[model samples]
Target chain A: MVKLLRSDFRRLWRSKLFYLGITAVAASVAFGLINNVHYKRIMLNLEIPIDNILFLGTLVIGFAIAIFTSFFVGTEYSDGTMRSKVVVGHNRSMIYLSHFLTTTFAAVFMMVIGTAVIVVVGIPWMGSFVTSCTILLPQILCCLLSIVALNAMILLLAMLIPSKAICAIVCLVLVMVMTNMISPTLWSKLEADPIIPEMSYTDSEGVVHTQPEQPNPHYATGTTRTILQLCYDMLPTAQMYQYGYDKIPKNIHLFPLYSVLFIGVLSTVGACAFRRRDLK
Target chain B: MEYVLTTSALSKKYRNFEALKDMTMHIPKGSIYGFVGRNGAGKTTLIRVICGLQEPTSGEYTLYGISNKDRRIAKSRHRMGAVVETPSIYLDMTAEDNLKQQALVLGLPSYERIPEILKLVGLENTGKKKARHFSLGMKQRLGIAVALIGNPDFIVLDEPINGLDPQGIVEVRELILKLNHEHGITVLISSHILGELSKLATHYGFIEKGHVVKEISAAELEAVCRRCIKVEVSDTKALIRVLDRMKKDYEVISDTQANIYGVVVLSELVLALAEEKCDLLASHEQDENLETYFINLVGGGENG
Candidate 1:
């Protein structure tokens, strides 16, 4: 397994796709920092803070991880190099585990580089974290775990799907859907308060009227709310949103556990399926 | 003779389709074993199972006396290498980098053999050229070079020459021969290209419908696939009478043609045929080749 890791990492360093991903991550973070500075000055209403920009790398790092994981593992299947590894006596379990380890390292490396760029540039532009740095450690750790869990799922798809093109397409589509639609939808529904607070408003007249509090129809209620909250907590992307944008997710303390469980479960399933899979 | 690889009732089934069923064969040490089969005839499937890319649905196989079920089979697999379907190479890396990656996989301590293997595969001067831009033949040779890195004594090549031009085919063919002869490596080549296989294989395993139809050495197959003289004459009756008088084994396939097996004294037979009023229009030697033998064994069809 160590040998396989060495080989895979060697290849990973040489892979153009991997480097391209790193570049994208670094640039995205750098651009986000620079854009924040511009937005702060241009839009006075935009309350952009260093805390918001602190883990901003977490949001876009998943995209880089997705592309790199797809091509990295997908190439093994597409180029049939994975078969060569097996042919030369490497155990399938070792091979699959090696891939998981190697890609995880790359994912972490990309995320770190993105974070470093943010830290280096973010402080100068938006000032230091308003919240205590140590107080933000839990969210920071959750962001890292979510990044890993997201990579684990993408790696799972890339390993199982043999066609490089198909695997790549599927991974990119999955990441886009999760980040754009599913995570945001879940966050909104989970964040909505069940009871609408009393509203005092002036509507087309100079007289103030107070509206009675009532059940918020859009808020997920009862069992549905429980399931939706669980999903929001479990999904790495949703967790990333909570960490990067939310002040502190209500489930901040439990997100890492969910991410770890997600990682453990997905890695086991991926390795087992990969071990039994037939290569052509 | 000792064998490098052996299988007993090994079967591989994918859902309802059986790629290999009770398939059994042997690859002798230091011999070029040609695995001949038609498309979808389980040639690649058998290779995949033995190479450990896929598990057998039932039955078992062995490498160098180590059973597939044994934990030590991986150690046995260390003595072998394979290039299944296409050349298993990272297209993004240069030829040298690819070999280095393979060496890392094998846990080899040095890159000392990289140059030698590249030279052997005739890719010594292809520096910094990524495999993706290499020609098909070059990629195939690079694959072989990668396999040759660990200095394994046995190698498996699945359809190694499937897409090569004539020149490319000859280059790969020569490489395989050199690997087996100079390095004394045993080669198990799975290919439907019988003509090409015939030129290289010292032993042959004919597979059909996931079954090993037969396993015979090249010499033994030569004796089995008899050489014959196909004669097209005006009167096969006269030809038959002359042949029978000469006590030759023959078969008359058509009204005007006959295949006289074994040796025939041409001038003496012509005189005898002339006396019998048999005018020989055409005569040619038909040495039953691998393709012919394969067709005859499995029955001729679109597969042939």
Candidate 2:
């Protein structure tokens, strides 16, 4: 197994596609950071929080890293190398595990480097604001976890789908679209109800006047909040967004634990499927 | 002794089509076995199955006397190497790196033998040049070098000479001979190139329609090939009279044709033929080559 992993690692390192992806992601992250800082300084004229800038910059970097991890696995499947791996007497389960580890390590490596570069370069530019280790550390760790989870989800789709490009594009588009489209409406539905019922006595014959009665807006029930929290917790990025950067949840810690479990389960399922798939 | 390799009614079914049907083969040890068949004759499938790439639908095989059903078959397979269909080398890597990767797969201890392996394949001087830039012959050699890792005693090469130049083919032929004769390795080589295989094979397995029709040693094949002498005769009776008088070893093929095997005095034969009122027609010698022999064995058809 060690020997197999060594060979796979060497192949990955020698691959031009892997290096090209890293360079592409690095370039994009640097460009986004430089542009974001310059615009904030000139246009807004307000003191920009380094945390906010870091968070925004890391989000874009995370997306790039996540998409590349998913695409790499898909490319291996389509390129016939995966079949070659099977031919060499390595177990299929080991092959999937090796690939998953490689991709996750690569994703985390890229995310850390990108985040470090942006924060180090952009923080000094801030006039008087000091970066807090308390917030920055957990935020960066959560960001890494979020990217890992995102990669797991995308890799699951990649394993199921035929075309790598189509899989990557569809996964990225769906994640962005679904998170934006569904989260807000679901949040609103979980929030307090605006409408109230007014009851007054009415005379049947004379039609006595009835006065409008205002009732207090009712907040979400504990059960409804728990369900919403469970849904958010099932997604790692949602969990990170809810509790990351030293922010504690007021209602429940359902988001973080659920998302971690969700990501772990998804990753395992993808690995198993990949292990059983016959490469033609 | 049990054969080094044996398959019992081995078969493979692909979707609605059966690629191989109850095919069984026994390959003895220390023989350069030539697997002769046309393209798509399930040669590759058989190789792949032995290599553990595809599962056989029914039946079983044994390698080194261990049954495929045995848990230790995989361990037995470690003694074997194969170049199935194409060389499984990474074209993006250098020849040295390619062999290194294969060595890693086979769990070699050190890089000490890598240079020797490269030199053995005549690829030691490739330097850092990647496999993509290598010529087709070079790539094939690299693939063989990769297979040679871990010093596997048994190697299966699927059409190793296919698509190579004459020089490249000769190089490969010499390499296979050296491996078998000098290193005591067993080679199972499959190819449509019958003539090339005839030069090196110790035994031949002639396959047709996914079945091995004949398996014979080179000595037996040569003996059965029938080197014949050609002679022309006016009449068989006259030829017989001449043959009787001269006591020559010959066969009276027909009234106009005969095969003379022993030496004959032309003047004496002519006189005898004249005395019997017989005339010589025409004579020519014939040597049956491997190609003609193969065509004769399998008969003329699309595969022939």
Best by lDDT: 1
How many steric clashes does model 1 contain? Answer: 0
Q: Compared with the true structure, what per-residue lDDT tens digits does model 2 show for residues A1-280?
A: 7876787677677767667666766676677767766777678765566566555433454456446765676665554345445554567667666766777777677666666666677667764335568745655566666667766676677766757788778877866654555544445655546545566676878776766766445545579767765665556555434433323434333434554776779878877776545344
- Which model scores highest in DockQ? 1
lDDT of 1 by residue, A150-216 (tens): 9899989988998888988898888889888998899888878889999998878788899999999
Q: TM-scores across all candidates?
A: 0.89, 0.75
Candidate topping TM-score:
1
Locate the minimum summed-lDDT window of 10 residues in model 1 chain B. B295-304
Screening candidate 2 with a backbone cut-off below 3 angstroms (N, C-alpha, C), the clashing residue pairs are A233-A255, A233-A259
TM-score, chain B, predicted structure 2? 0.83
How much does each candidate deviate at the interface, measured as C-alpha RMSD after superposition?
Answer: 0.7, 2.9
